[model samples]
Target: MSALGAVQPAEAAGGTRAERGDRESLFRPLSAEDGEQLPAEIESLCMNCFQNGVTRLLLTRIPFFKEIIVSSFSCDSCCWSNTEIQSAGRVQEQGVRYRLAVTSRQDMDRQVVKTDCATATIPELDFEIPPFTQRGVLTTVEGIIDRAIAGLEQDQPIRRATDEGVAQKIEEFIGRLRQLKEAQSPFTLVIDDPSGNSFVENPRAPQRDDALVVTRYRRSPQQAAALGLQGEELEEPAEPAEDLHNEVLQFNTNCPECNAPAHTNMKLVQIPHFKEVIIMATNCESCGHRTNEVKSGGAIEPQGTRITLRITDPSDMTRDVLKSETCSVEIPELEFELGMGALGGKFTTLEGLLKDVRDLVERNPFTLGDSSAPDRTQKLQEFIGKLQEIIEGQRTAHFVMDDPAGNSYLQNVFAPEQDPEMQVQHYERTFQQNEDLGLNDMKTEGYEEETGSR
Candidate 1:
């Protein structure tokens, strides 16, 4: 039998009403333009338990989301009923995430959220909420917290491992959480999803509020694994993923510099501690020029990371580095700064990257030998000498990487931070950067840069 009744246009919803004593209500649709002109009927069996039911998928339109299809299904043979959504258009240019601060009760009902591939967390309490492949949520701030409560209540690992005392403390914590919900106390809710499928409500009307923080980032390898993007093939013997990695994919595209067709090389590499990443290299045989790029195979980091290495000896030159395309590399001694797209991202040692930088400067038409600007040429020559010395362990230098997307890394198998020579700091992206990244509705007027100590 059909789980949904009939396809009809959505009208004004009698919005969820709540008394102080009642539980928070579900989100109410506020005057949709038109919804479900036609509903698609399909066969339905619960992917979970193999229960049978007929499904009805209705098409609708959201404000910023454009086309959306909401699917409703209920299994008659089992207790499985769900309403999920599939957006036809995308809102984020990259992996999207959100941080909503719940300070008032009204903020809860003014938003919509999705957690399909998200790892929601409230760091203050060390609570992590995993999306169980359920539909994205269209609810308020209170609803977000309630979902976290539900996950904690049903957490099997904690329940199985904890004794009565620990279990009691957990229950007490949950009670405090409920109290906070009712009290509308302030708490930060972070949703990190690399799929770019999640959404936090924003009405582009009169000025929007700043209680919620929205971000788009490049995912790391480890974060991508949480979304089941990698490591799944390792379980069952799979030749496809392995074979594809070994076989280099090539393309025939015209070079940006030369009119001649360029041969492009692309292959996947699994970084030891990080996730699998694809390296793309393009070479123009006509002009004898080459270009390369590295992309993180995981979910983008929520915050940006800055890595600094003091090269005291040549051995430091061998330290592995993963520089993302969005990363910026700088050498203070040379007064040289290369922004994103300098060489694109690559997995190389510190020495190798520096070599590429010097080579790039050397080849630049403006920076070539004995320039019209003699003083500038002298500085470049001295910088090159110092770089060579550092490579040969004759002089020391400092290497700094500032990445707003936080995908770049300087590999330190040991605790580099403890050595006092290496430093890793994660800072909140500046107001200008957030604007540049298309993170609208941000207000960082008096915002001080907060540094995260590694």
Candidate 2:
């Protein structure tokens, strides 16, 4: 049976709601069979015939993706059928963009999960499939080309009879699209999903795919508004609230793990003689997940900050560390490096950050699948062992953090006097670094006149 057909409702397992709630809701194995049961259907008017038809719905979870409701409509009178997939999960914390190089016929056969909110762009042809233009689908890359061809051909006959010029241009475009499907030349397929639910198949799974690059980015305010995630922004006040900096302020938020309602506590903290910062902590009672984040309370510094610490003593792990979301971490001894935004913002000790890094690598889905190689697994094991040894003070390593925004901090044991083992340097940020931080696009100096003219 197909992946969609083999799935049954969560109730099939015969568990109480409370019992199932203990685990991730609606999370169950999708590898088994339950095809004997008929799918739930509802009577609906079919668009093809305007006649009464049946719409079948199935709730199934994709292997990599969360729960999704797959629906299919059939019209007996018109012999028409339509299938659609809708995400059943909550919005993710970050948007995902996938860039894939399609160079061969095998690449064309790769499966893709295109969510309704994803935009597929082909830079080579200057063609784009905008969001909401097509229903979400579980199909191969070739199938997408075929669908585009069918859409273009659907109205060609009418256009040809009246507007031959337009029809001719469309025909040429269709020919080019057909050539793309044949994989005659190398091209790029970009899927940008604001909902972070879309996916393109990776032929090399457990290992990194050289031809595919995946990036997660924070959505713009406009994009967040489009996704119905924009919250009310508090306006700055001329006067500060009484004791606001000293008190922990609480606010309601959804849990990232389970999307359950939770509370986040925020507090303003001053790092003695250094700078003020805002610390936020969230705890989800339902999932027992906790997270702490720190944001720089002051204005952006003129230069970037880089801190390097030599970890020689076990007490070094106990020192407080603030790793901003824009910080990149590295350990030269192990040849290990972590890029910016890998762990988001953190307000924790050195040991805690190292533990989080170890957990992130160990729990990565790519390292556990059938595509995982024995050699790769062994290497990861060795790397993880080294990290554990460092955490346990069995070995020495150099820890480096580079923050282009100059917001990260590492507590110094000898505060009044600089520590011999730690080195802090402030340097001008490069052009590319400013661009990555969105500083290049900011026009703070001339914004008054520009806004008035607009």
Candidate 3:
């Protein structure tokens, strides 16, 4: 907000997505006018009729903050419902954090927590719940741990063959958490949020002896950079990479599909997140057919790169993903994939990319036309439904992009605090790929540049 936070509507601009500091808001902020009372706890409106509104809401005073309110609303006519947690007090420029010890089951319910841009950790268990990956919620300490467990299971990141030890440790961590929840073990829970909207319930402060530890510190420089608040920008490049980029290869041949004359266009353009790769496009003049493929360029990469993301919520749809021409994308759960030539390199969000796949499969005249077989159309219809399910969060799917050229990325808002599922794995490239990228060449500094094959 504008220094003084205010509860803003969804359409309101300038404020954050989590600001709710109005007088009628759920919570009576610390800076509110003296003796100001809030509106009714429950209310609803007919979004369609406008005149008719119902009272369907639940309001509770959160024990942690003075007069803090949590509310849930539902509409009778449209069946729309939403739960909101309103933060109290003034603008928390530095943010607030909470650390509580969980020694008994009774403490689980009492350890207040707030999160969204929040990261949580259980020190005794060595379990961490990453920030931004989780939906913002006001929950108990137990609820937070439970959510982390669910996230781990839905992600299914552990592989049987690779990182077996890490997988085992994860399992052990989960088991210990269960024990902690049962009050069989004691642990410490830390809730750190940079948004300044979070807090823990602590009655005793500096005045009296207190077990609670509350620390308010300025955001780190790197964190400020990631959050887009402030940071030093990178120095200007000597010259844009594209200016120095050169053509790689070109050839003329009959179109593979139509057997008609065609010219192949090849260029070495740098992908933003990935490395440089040669993009080739062939168009047939006779048949009006086109094909494209991405190949490794320049010196061969020492390792291939794999990027993975789990589609779990609506927020995940907005994640920026880059798939270079050489990248192979797949959704294992749906058994659908695109090889190099089947799709071209581009940058897009998960939502935009999935929509592209749907349009190509369901609306394409070439694929689902009148002459198409009934069985094929039926299968495509089923796949389209699966895609819809993923978008609606009815199902979970893992999206992976494997690029031999190491030129692909699933970008995160906070690069340093990347989620586990959104990862980049570097592995050895295949010998064939090494040859394709021309890594076999030994010529280097001061060596003569040769045009033809040795």
Candidate 4:
């Protein structure tokens, strides 16, 4: 039996089976002639007919992504059939969002892999397919719209019998959806997968697809809890018997890399003339993966802080910098901007941060393989070259760090005298910024009154 609990093909028709590993067993595409037969189906109870039927499972790898298991069920008694897909690989560390512009009818033929954790949205019509509303599927763009139509139409008959007004409104909405199939006007299709398991096809692979924009972002605490990730339940231990500010504390935790038991060592350190900060380091023996994260120990400041430094000398790279989780880094010279949460809180030198940024851009999955475009590739290369020159002290550029939480820091070589090349400014955070940090929703003043009313 394969990993999907189905019979393995004794001999794949035209497909080749790679040597099975402890973690993954890969199967290539099988010839249509013997595809379904060789794999052999397993008897499954049909939901519609309550009779014995066969379910076929095929495990194959996607060209640009990872492996997936495709399954189909059919019942000859009722002629009922269904198809679904499941990601056979591990979930990524960060969630992914794909924005695709559907301008032509041919765009509808592009393939899509939408995991159960993904939500599809058509902004133009304000129509959305929420996660878990339907089973995971390996289908085309058109197929997604068709599925939405099917779902809306499924309940129309009942609504028509009960409420004529609601049914008429739905009928008109369905008509609009049908017109979208014509692809007369361009519309944006967004697929947001917090699990990072979903994928949308790019007809132009190995090259940049101007119509598609992909973004990877760190998951929120709520999202992490929903996915059952570790560290959420671990509360800060009561101040140890020893002074924690001067001592390192170790606690058992699961490794984010391998999901194996590991110990995380944490320490609270007070920066000279600054603030207290907590640092955590974790190492996994199972996967030989090591990670460290820094967190601010104080609450959000009353105003945001922005620091700008003119980098002219190579010595500037040696200056220590502390970047909080809510900070954004920008270098106008390279036309580069890194938003918050790209790299979690980090305490490193100025040079280290730039190198990290370069690595992040270079390691982008879409920049490689068939999805990379020549012009896009050239632009990236040029940008990287300029960044390298800056790192090598061959160029001069202004580096800016903006932290809405007002916790980030950039070292001042001149200390109390203040460096002539740097400027620090403080400003109040906007309502949207406060909302993003969940500050606007907080009720610190009168929660007791609301509770008494309840």
TM-score of each: 0.42, 0.74, 0.36, 0.71
Off by over 4 Å in 4: 5-85, 88-113, 119-128, 138-143, 153-168, 178-237, 240-242, 445-454
* lDDT value for model 2: 0.79
Q: Could you report the Cα RMSD, in angstroms, for every candidate shown?
A: 20.5, 5.6, 26.3, 7.0
lDDT of 2 by residue, 142-259 (tens): 9888988999999999999999999999999999999999999889999999889887866543234678877788788878888887892444633456897778888888777555
Q: Tell me how far the alpha carbon of residue 310 in candidate 2 is from the true structure, in angstroms, after superposition.
A: 4.9
Model 4 TM: 0.71
User: What are the lDDT figures for the candidates, one per model?
Assistant: 0.64, 0.79, 0.60, 0.79
- Candidate 1: tens digits of C-alpha lDDT, residues 305-368: 8888888866788888899877888878666677654476888899899898877655432234
User: Which pairs in model 2 have colliding backbones?
Assistant: none
Model 3's TM-score against the true structure: 0.36
Pairs with steric clashes in candidate 3: 7-21, 30-89, 95-196, 274-407, 275-407
Q: Write the per-residue lDDT of candidate 4 for residues 1-454, one digit (tens) a residue.
A: 2335432332211121232342233444322233333443778888898998788887665645666778888999999998888776556778999899999998999889998878899999999998877888999889998998998999998999999999999999888888887786788999999889899986654334778877777787877766677564436557555677778889898776456688999899887657988889998766666888889989999899999999999999999888998898989887777777767898889999999988866765344444455677677778889999999999999999999999999999998887999999999999978876778988878899989999
The candidates, ranked best first by lDDT, are 2, 4, 1, 3
Residue 283 lDDT (model 4): 87
Residue 55: error of model 4 in Å?
8.5
Compare candidates 2 and 3 on lDDT and give the better one. 2
